[model samples]
Target: MNELLLTGDERDRAGARLLALLDSYERGLPKAEILPEPDRDVLASLLAAPMPERGVGVDALFDRWEDTILPNSTAVAHPRFLAYVLGPPNGIAPYAEAVAAALNQNCNFWQLSPAASVVERSVLEWLASVVGFPAQAKGILTGGGSLATLQALATALNDRVPDFHANGLQRASAPLVVYTSVEAHRSVDKAAAILGIGLDNVRHIATDSVHRMDVGALRAAIEEDRADGLRPWCVVATCGTVSTGSVDPLDDIADLCAAEDLWLHVDGAYGALFLLSEEMRGLMGGCARADSITLDPHKLLYASLEAGCLLVRDGAKLRDAHAFDSSYLTVAEDPLMTDYMDYGPQLSRNFKAFKVWSALQAFGVSAFREANVRTLGLARRLGEGIEATPGLTLLAPVTLTAVCFAVDGASDDDHTALLERLAAENVALLGPVVVAGRRGIRACVTNHRTSEADIDLVLEWLQSRLTGRR
Candidate 1:
């Protein structure tokens, strides 16, 4: 018998325990602390423990997970987990992940994972349709938004820089410059740095009072770069910025990129999937005009973490940038399938698509749309509540689902203390933000489980604290 293989009875017991654990966790999510204080001694013991010479068996393994692991884990699925852009997994996510692991599809080539490649393509095609991309558009799932942006910039370089494959950034007559709003994700700067575009060449254009990218400022920056003999190659727009959920002027930015002959990449990791709501289309519809866009299913679709996407309007360009000739992996092109290895940087990829696809299939699109709409409403409610509160001030407009506010006359230290207090007392887990240099609290409604009652409870607590302090 294989040493790693579990006996039939052991496998049955393990399955039962797994199901019980999942059910209990889901049921207990509402009561669980959003951020529990971890026991350092227990963690240290885990680190210090040695591997056993003999097998621990299924029951012992489950005991370890229940007694140590579960107690220490963060309750990201809790309704009050409104700190960052992270979202809880959909109900189907765990089961989908388990099945995906068992299948163990390589997902690189058609022969190795025919069904998985098709499933991934179906998911991508559906996403492209939601963004209103043309049939020629193509994309690949990434580890997250950062990697997707990096891949997009790399594709832009290959497409714009002549003979880039043969001579990458070496012996160039002038440095290539990229443009993005100051509110854009740091991933843009990171991508530029990694691609040898250099951070110095990336211009963070100013934003307007509402935090949207200042188009005039961006245009002037491009003109200045061109006059300086630098190559202005691309513009990274933000559909939903990190701090304020502010969407840059995508239509204006797209027009500028077209006139200047620059590639347009929209980083919609935080907000693109908001398009699932038809009501959000007017605000975010300009995403289709981009040459490429980055999206995070893990953020909005509430899939398990580490699933991002980069969709390019011109499928040929993405292929031109990433595909390479390989002798051992050659296969005739089939219209029904795609060799994912030709799409992006990975030669060995897991079936990340399965979890996403499974969730969509199980819950249907309408469920996700309703969930998004609900989050938007809850955010609006919180923003209005903050505005009406005596000691609070709205730091930014409620654009999507992020509400930025501050306790009036509070210092940065005060805000930090308030955040710690909220988390410690289980009032709500909130993040601290500095909007335009004034430190504040940021409550982002990314969790589907978050409700109007949850928002009200947090607001009531904040109001009382501010009143007492005053």
Candidate 2:
């Protein structure tokens, strides 16, 4: 086991190799492919290889990564990679991640991870302030937005369901119903199902022309369910819907949830961070009224993968949902630090906040705000361009950083072919989306590396393709 630890020379060599790899990757990102079709033969070889009793040494492993791994990976940091609401990691993320890995802190209990606990708390505090949540707001870092939503639902269960910990939904008298818009992410339904709330009990409420959840329809559904003797447990509203970037009427939904005594959770995984921009506050400030909100720092904060958060208005409720005591893990509480095991589902949690904190500390919040504002501008530009183009149709309002549009008189296959062609030619990697049964292409300006020129190039390509000139 001791041999697993590298000597000082080995550590130095590995660190130097990693730094070189990072430098080369940053320099080559401009010309890199946004999407790379992997070689199945190479992947098959990796799968078939047997584990050796002895390690192959660090040098050989680094060589393998350069040769077999780098080529097959998607260049998510590419400037023109505008498929999903995914952002490239900030400049300092790699260094922070490396440091966190070396520290190997389990951010579960305060005594075991005092400094990590404070760091995570600091990050959560800033996030809460960003969303305009009250000082009492507290949250836990999660795997991603999906997991955050799941945890939010779990917290709601503990808060609303009588004796949830004791009965665990097995002794429920009436079927519990969850309400969300049809435009909401599938994660809502998945969470409901996983939490023993049957899919049949979920009401996919109708949306308006802009794809926002119709509050009237939601209210009517809740009333109908109540009349039918079913319990309306929770409402999951989308701050930025995945399909069209439509924000559900948060204030109206919050009012309804309050009156009905139902939990209100805003899935702001894609759009919540937009609150960083002063211009976005009006559209998203209503998120503060939600009992809980899900945010993905990895999406808009430019943090590396696997950084999502769930913030609850009443912090104690979140702790009640997941805290468990064990004699073997007994530890004294500290006034300045938090035992994060009381917050969410994980017992052994990684120090995920370091990368986010490091990026913010290195670049400052103003830098991120500027980048986000720019992405919003680029999205609006794309929408305007699509509307101005002779052969294209704007499918949805350019809200947040997602611009969804379709080619006039084109079928789903036509849009698919265009996507494939553009990706093959390295013009861009746009995603496919369907709004109100209309299939179209969606370009989300979530990449900090994306520029106005890149958007222009994509539009130019589409125009050329439409005119049969390419």
Candidate 3:
């Protein structure tokens, strides 16, 4: 073969086929019933089989994806999909992802991906600006919210402990403790565990009646830990508790951190991006005060899977935590740009910023703001509907998109059955939520595709189910 991997004609043909496949999926969204109970046999056939002796061509792969793979995936783009806190990707993601793959920009360093580095910086700056942080704030896009939180915790660990990377957690004189509400995401605990911070070191602080973290109790816990000679270093606050969409008292948490000289890390993965709307700015103003914050672009920016960012107010601290020089990988960096390899654990990163920036540009910031506001409105409507229903008891405050409600005389098994029934009938897919040790059906309106009509249909489904049971 000559010095070529693929001929120009072959490349063009592949591109054309990809474009066609994408077009077909986009067109299928409209009258597609929003969901279809997946044929488990067909799905198992696709995944259960091992690799073939001969590779499947692009055409066969595309055919397999269309025929078998897609139906099993949750149709988050469907207007009726109001289950988990998942956002459908914006229209530009498919084309942008294709371009990113073709270009194969190594975003770990400026020398390897200059334009990509700048574009990522631009996207991060825009995100920081929305949170009312200054230009000095710095961040990097990671795989998703969990990775971002993991990176943030690692950075905090580095900042508080001297020579952490060298000695590791084993040599530390005192074990550091992290405070978080019981309502916090499991990602916090997962990150702590991954970083060698024992589970016992994590303090599951109690929350108030409304589910926000109890700041006074947190202070007491920290004081107790300190008195016991254990180091209390960081407090992880959550913006959206997964079960109830309850936002922690950020202002109070920030004040407590300031008084205690502790790192304040806000896990804003499910809720921070709402700051795009002016209406949410007042409630989330204290986000600017956080030492570091984690956000999920896949959830809020509507970017395709695996776009999360960890933003830090002090850029130098992030660098201090992650940057290290090695003979094999050393390279010069420009003052204006970031060598992102110095910012996170991964060195070979994809050009994730292109898809995020492309989506934002194609849809505009106003569209996202309106979409967020619409979701908030839909959640409030859902809460009111649940309250008005004869047998339904609104379990928690509808602070955000998550609506949890208990049906009279329904056991946890009843809720599980009801959820399956809803999904099987294509009424609407809702999961279960546990509130005060009792299980209830949870419908979260996180998708921008979800409309008021969809909400009413789900309510109708509930009514029909209740009548059938009676």
Count of residue pairs whose backbone atoms collide, per candidate: 0, 0, 0
lDDT score for residue 251 of model 2: 93
Q: What is the C-alpha lDDT of each candidate?
A: 0.94, 0.92, 0.88
Off by over 4 Å in 3: 1-13, 30-44, 47-56
Candidate order, TM-score descending: 1, 2, 3
lDDT of 3 at 124: 95
lDDT of 1 by residue, 338-405 (tens): 99998999999999999999999999999999999999999999999999999899999999999999
TM-score of each: 0.99, 0.98, 0.95
258-310 in candidate 2: lDDT tens per residue? 99999999999999999999999888889999999999999899999889999
TM-score for candidate 2, residues paired by index? 0.98
Instruction: Give, for candidate 2, the lowest lDDT window spanning 10 residues.
Output: 327-336
Q: What is the RMSD, in Å, between candidate 2 and the native fold over all Cα?
A: 1.0
lDDT of 1 at 213: 95
lDDT score, candidate 2, position 197: 95
Best by lDDT: 1
Model 2's lDDT to the true fold?
Answer: 0.92
Candidate 3 per-residue lDDT, tens place, 114-142, comes to: 89999999999999998777778899999
Worst 10 residues of 1 by lDDT: 461-470
Q: Please give the lDDT score at residue 237 for candidate 3.
A: 94
